[model samples]
Target: MKIEVNVKKRYFFALLGILLVLGGVFAVYAYNSNPPNPRVFGHTINEVDGITCNSGQAVTRTAAGWSCVNIASSGGSTPVNPVNTLSYFEDFIDRGDTSEVNHPGIISFQGYAGKTFGYIHSKDMFDITFLVKGNGTLYGLSSYESFYVGLVDASVSSRIYFFISGGNWQAGTRNGGSTKVTNLNTGVSIGNSPEWFKLRIKRVDAGTIEFFINDASVGTINSNVPVMPMQIFAATPGEADGRLHVLIDYIDLKITNLAR
Candidate 1:
């Protein structure tokens, strides 16, 4: 009887030990399967504009949170190139002549307000198709305060001005005393943004020109226009208190079949 009782005690002790070992293993497995958030543990997740930033994006911490920036697509160091066949291109890096002028101050190549850009005044014009990429702010004035980029006739009285005013676009032409204008509603969308844009203006025909914003056609004008000898200008004329700032990345002029 004593031996049987001792055997029963031994068996009971062995089973209890095995059960304890199994419970410990199960506890460890459960912990490994459901852990805390990796961000909480590693603390590497970046916050952008109160939102979490994904991997491989550059970010700057703002007053509220972080801001994701396009370090790759935003700024430019190389000269702008033509997408299609071209006859002329100006990267705005080097002005080949002194014909360029800045009335209030000297023109800059280092860029304006930390934007990498330049400006120019071309003496001659090629059959025109070019992309003008930049941004500026234009204010209203009573007098003739024109901030424009486009073809200007020799007399200056006849002009096709692709200008911005009152946060709107003006595709305007003045021939002698007669004037015509087309207003585009893209100003509020384009104004005051740090992002670069592609403003393409092309001569569609002898009597017509088309204007585009980021490859989208804003408008087309049909009017009697001058020939190709028009001066390619970036100008702020008859300045008053009205302010105009245009920062250009490049102007790639191409001679397409339409130009020919």
Candidate 2:
């Protein structure tokens, strides 16, 4: 009887010890899996930008004329990224704005606070086509993308297009074998150098669209509504002409549904 009692106690202690160890492990995993949210960097913003670049330093051709700009954010539940550079006169391209970027870099400004952009990446297919200029590296399409919200009052419309290689190899577009832009999905073409280029994304009536480079229609998209892709982005893939310099101007977005 004494031996039996001792054996039972030992088994209970061993089981309890194992359970405690597992619990600790689970706690650690939970903590590690969930990273903390991003906190505001500081009390004030101190970054320069080229948000609304001048019309023609590098843009000799109409299709290559693009004014680039840097982006910013507000800590007080403020809007960042998806900036309405043309809509709000305050957002301008500094002509001297460069910064680091990554996926999900944009947070919704006009929407309710806490609205953030997710990786609405394109599939291996489902793309529009575009053209490239100058000999340089042309990176792959971004499965992830951006979209702009056009506030319309009872449904207004605009024409949109895209050009990948005119403004100093600073644009991206997607296309299939056809040079037609509408058939492509995404394209990001550029070279690593200080060059000026032109690109146009014209959205027409929320349906017919065109992508132009240097005033030439390189591609077009025919859908029920315009793409109005809110974000323009690229990832550095391993390649030859290894270095690249890319830029994106503004998409001429027209609104029909206005609150006023």
Candidate 3:
């Protein structure tokens, strides 16, 4: 009888230990399956209920954790791939130009015939867009008079620029102070009046540059594209007839795939 009692006591302890191990496994499973609110010092901590995402992104939960994702539109549009981009925009409503013209929605640059007026100095190369128009017509003065809008390097020698000279629209680029210029004369004449023209310059790749006017593709330059960092510049080199001024509606720069 003493032996049997000792054996029974051992069985009881063994059964208790087995139950404890099973309970621990079940607790771990439960925690992983539906994790309870995190606790600290015996107090339940508040968890973030929602997260904010950028323009084309949404918050979602994956197996590992919560993260941001690009979401599709409700209209069944294709999902846009996410890209890292830096952008800058100026409408000139609150900013003043060298002319100090306190207009409601425009910035004016009025200067002498030989001088250049620049607005924004960007840190690097960017896809640029601007709305601009000159004050008067100085056609047939291509050699001496022009209005320039686009990217230019610090020395003003290397650039990818769009210019209207002698009422003709042209896209040109110069590399490393080389006098040889790659020009695309669009043959489309632009009048120097109050009407604004939308001009865009986009760097397609390391070797290509695209130009657009009023949302139409005018030309592309495959060579002579400046590789150096450039600034957004607009200059009105006045004609011999009178002082030239430029009125700008806005300027926007979108930078992607920055150089390392």
Question: How well does candidate 3 match the true structure in TM-score terms?
Answer: 0.51
Q: How far is candidate 1 from the true structure (C-alpha RMSD, Å)?
A: 21.9
TM-score of each: 0.42, 0.27, 0.51
* Deviating ranges (above 4 Å) for candidate 3: 1-105, 112-125, 137-144, 239-243, 257-260
Q: Is candidate 1 or candidate 3 better by lDDT?
A: 3
Q: Write the per-residue lDDT of candidate 3 for residues 12-121, one digit (tens) a residue.
A: 99999999999999999987773233221100111212332332343334566545444322112222221121112223111222222221122334432112223332
By TM-score rank, best first, the candidates go 3, 1, 2
Q: Summarize candidate 1's per-residue lDDT along 1-260 as a digit string, tens digits.
A: 99999999999999999999999999999877633321111012121112322211233434654454322211233211211211122332332422222111111111112221222222222223233322223433112234456666555555665666665555666554355433344442544443334555666655676777666787876664544334555553332221332333233444321221
Model 1, position 255, has a per-residue lDDT of 37
Instruction: Name the lDDT of candidate 3.
Output: 0.53
Q: Is candidate 2 or candidate 3 better by TM-score?
A: 3
RMSD of each: 21.9, 20.2, 20.4
Q: What is the TM-score (0 to 1) of candidate 1?
A: 0.42
State the lDDT of candidate 2 residue by residue for 84-115, as single tens digits: 32121112222222332221111212112111
Task: Tell me the whole-model lDDT of each prediction, alpha carbons only.
Answer: 0.41, 0.30, 0.53
Candidate 1 wrong stretches, greater than 4 Å:
1-145, 177-189, 193-195, 237-244, 256-260
Candidate 2 backbone clash number: 77
